[model samples]
Structures are given as structure tokens and as C-alpha cells.
Target: MSDAQRICLGAIAGAFGVKGELRLKSFTSEPEDIAAYGPLESEDGALSFEITLTGQSGKGALIARLSGVNTKEQADALRGVRLYADRGRLPALPDDEFYHADLIGLEVFDTGGAPLGRVKAVLNHGAGDLLEIHAPGMTASVLMPFTREAVPTVDLTSGRIVADPPEGLF
Candidate 1:
């Protein structure tokens, strides 16, 4: 399926044990919910797997077994493979919340309405989410905190974001 129709839920970190279990790093809010959306597809949509979560590993990663994997070699071969679920299978979000995928590519503008840039990516480095904005004639992208104060408005229907970033942030 196309990326627009699917949302990435997690990725295979590596083989977990000799019995074919895999280490999975979930991107879901509740990490374990990664497996609740039913079977997941590979990034290219060429492979599908039914995840059976076995336990949790270090750093909050999960231990899981794929439907057909039964050997360390089989699981190792799939390491680093990202897993995606159909968007329709996911629950709708409450207002004021948005999927990172939806935020990317949205135009960002300053409070005064001058164009700042387009969102290059949404990233979280533990503290909170940040919007990576890429603009013209800039040597590097600007990272703006994704907060109620920093970003006052996000109109998904209009594909725009109105940001009142801290002084000198632009």
C-alpha cells in the first residue's frame, strides 16, 4: 500500500533469541498497541507479518514473534524492517492531536503571516516533539518546539501551521 494509506507503527530492531523471537521498537503511543492493529506490512508492502508480542526488552522495546519466522536466521534477515498498519484500522485522534505523518509537508508561517518554511519532519528527542522546518536560502533547517505557545495553530484542512516561535527562532 502507498505510504499515504498506511502509517508506520514499529520496526524490527533485530533477532531477539534463538527461537526466532524479534526485538521490535514500537512507535505507537502504547508500544504494545503496535500489534493490536492486526497484521502489519513491510515498508515496501512486499511482506506481511502477524505479530505476537512475547514480552518487553531493554529500553522499552518489545519481544515479538512473527507468524512464519521460526529460526534466528529468519528473524535476523528481517532486522531493520519497518512495519506499517493500514490507516483505516487505527483509531481517530481527538482534536488538538495529529499524526506526525500529517504534519510533514505542511506549510509553516509566522504569526504575522510571512511564510517561514515547510515542515521537513517531526522529531522528538525525549523532551517533546519538534518541527523541522526547511526554508529557502538557509544553510540548515530550524527546529521549532511543537507546543501550544510555539505553534498556536495547525489547520490540517488548509495544510498550514501558524507558529509564534520564541524570539529570534526564525
Candidate 2:
């Protein structure tokens, strides 16, 4: 799918209860707002579900009911599934901010125009975002800090990022 089509909004944690309730982890700044965009679909768009806010669970989680899910087994089958909303429904981002979807697959380069790699994934472990880049001739991808100092420039329009990696990091 094109980058302009799908924007990830949330993820399914697992089944909350026997009645097909789901433990949802919303990625929106205002978590509850995820339901405003409309029905969410899986990455492949093969599965679609209308989400309803049931209540708030512990630790920034929401209890939700999927339109067609009526059994715990059905909900369990969806654990770890990411939810995407139509990109048109999402708001525009500020200049310095970027969606994880937009960052993935962008070519990364050093300040001197040396090819580093393409961003394979964007990861956040409750600290800050990391750009996982898989460079040529490397066995594994390297995690580069997304900070301004480390990554001097990000030209989304051109699908390129200029990174100033630390000593011996590349």
C-alpha cells in the first residue's frame, strides 16, 4: 500500500474478557481519539473492525469491543495485530514530527552523501524513537538515534535522511 493510504493508530494487546472485549494500546497522543477516525483495519486490509470504547483499563490501555468479535477465542486470534486508520482521517503533523510509517523504507545517508542504509523499522521502547537501518554488507541492522544531532536532516519529500552517526557506528 502507498504511504498516503494507511496510518497506524493502535494495536491490540489481547482479549480483555470472555465477551470479546479487547485490551487495546492506542498510539494516538489522545488515546481515546483513535475511535474517532472510523473503522480500523489490519495491515493487509483483509480484516476490518469497528472499535467502540468500553472503558479505560490500567496503564494507559483501553477496553474495546470489536464489531464482529464475540468470543474470547476470536479476540485472542487478533493479539498483536496493528490497527490502521485511513490517512485522510488523521490530522497533519507539525514540521519536525513524522509518523513511523513515513520513516520506514527511507534511504539514510551520512552527512557527506555516503549511503548508510534504508530504514527497516522505527522502534520506541518507552524512551525515544530509534531508526533501525540495514546497511549494505551488514549482518544486522543498526539502531540509530532519531535525535537532531545524530540525524541532521530528514527530507521526507525526497525519501532521504542524513545521519551523523557516532564514531565507528556505521
lDDT of each: 0.92, 0.92
Model 2, position 64: C-alpha lDDT score: 96
Assess candidate 1 and give its TM-score to the true structure: 0.94
Lowest lDDT 10-residue stretch of candidate 1: 1-10
Candidate 1 lDDT over 12-117, as tens digits, reads 9999889999999988888889989999999888899999999998767899999999999999999999999899999999889988888999999998999999
- Which one wins on TM-score? 1
Worst 10 residues of 2 by lDDT: 1-10
lDDT of 2 by residue, 88-161 (tens): 88999998988888999999999999999999998877788899999999999999889999998989999999
TM-score of each: 0.94, 0.91
Residue pairs in candidate 1 whose N, alpha carbon or C atoms collide under 3 angstroms: none
Best by lDDT: 1
